[model samples]
Target: MNVKSINILMIDDDAINLKLTEVMLKKHANVNEIIKASNGLDALGVLDKRGDIDLILLDIVMPVMNGLEFLSNVYSKNSNFNIPIVVLTTDETVKKEAMSRGANGFIAKPIAEQALIQEISKLIDLG
Candidate 1:
């Protein structure tokens, strides 16, 4: 498949995870840009300012606002909002809840590069 570079909004409270994810994406995916947000609230702000976000990688646990809360807010604000959101978390228990809340996909944390890419490809036309 033909690869298309995309802009990703990554929302995680951990600085280390953000950096590591960025590095992994840069190395493995055709990423045009990677926007980082430390929390869901900040991610919302980023979304407000940018319209080109192709995908969202969100953590379940965060300060200010959690991934589930963010999903609620985003879907509540605009039912037609189409950006694909993939919930990234270590807690597998929240998988069903997150998916029901509007998450298009779910990935267990310590995100594998291949899995991440596959999930993105499934939600987006990367070819």
Candidate 2:
């Protein structure tokens, strides 16, 4: 996939995870830009400010709004923003639930760089 122009939004409460993912994605995906948010509310703010995001990597547990609630809000919102979201979590048990709630893909935490690249590439290419 030609991911050179893809802008990604990463929502996670852990600063280390966000930084690590950003670095890994930069190296592996050659992504255009990555916007980081500590929580879903902050993610929405970033979205409002920058509407060109192509994909979202979201965490399930967060302070303000969890990933599920964020997904609900995004779909329910009046805007026609149809960006694909990939749920990033440590709990593999929620994989089915996350997909059912609108996640385009799922990735367990302590993310493997290659796996993340492959998964994201598929989604971006398909979209």
Superposition TM-score, candidate 1 onto the true structure: 0.95
The number of the candidate with the highest lDDT is: 1
lDDT by residue (1-127, candidate 1, tens digit) is: 7778899999999999999889888985578999999888999899989999999999989999999999999988888999999999999999999999999999998898889888988998877
Query: Poorest 10 consecutive residues of model 2 by lDDT?
Result: 73-82
Clashing pairs in 2: none
The global Cα lDDT (0 to 1) of model 2 is: 0.86
Q: What is the C-alpha RMSD of each candidate to the true structure, in Å?
A: 1.3, 2.3
Runs of candidate 2 exceeding 4 Å displacement: 1-3
- Judge candidate 2 at residue 12 and give its lDDT: 96
Report the lDDT tens digits of candidate 2 across residue range 8-49. 999999999999999898875358788889998888888888
> Residue 103 in candidate 1 has what lDDT?
98
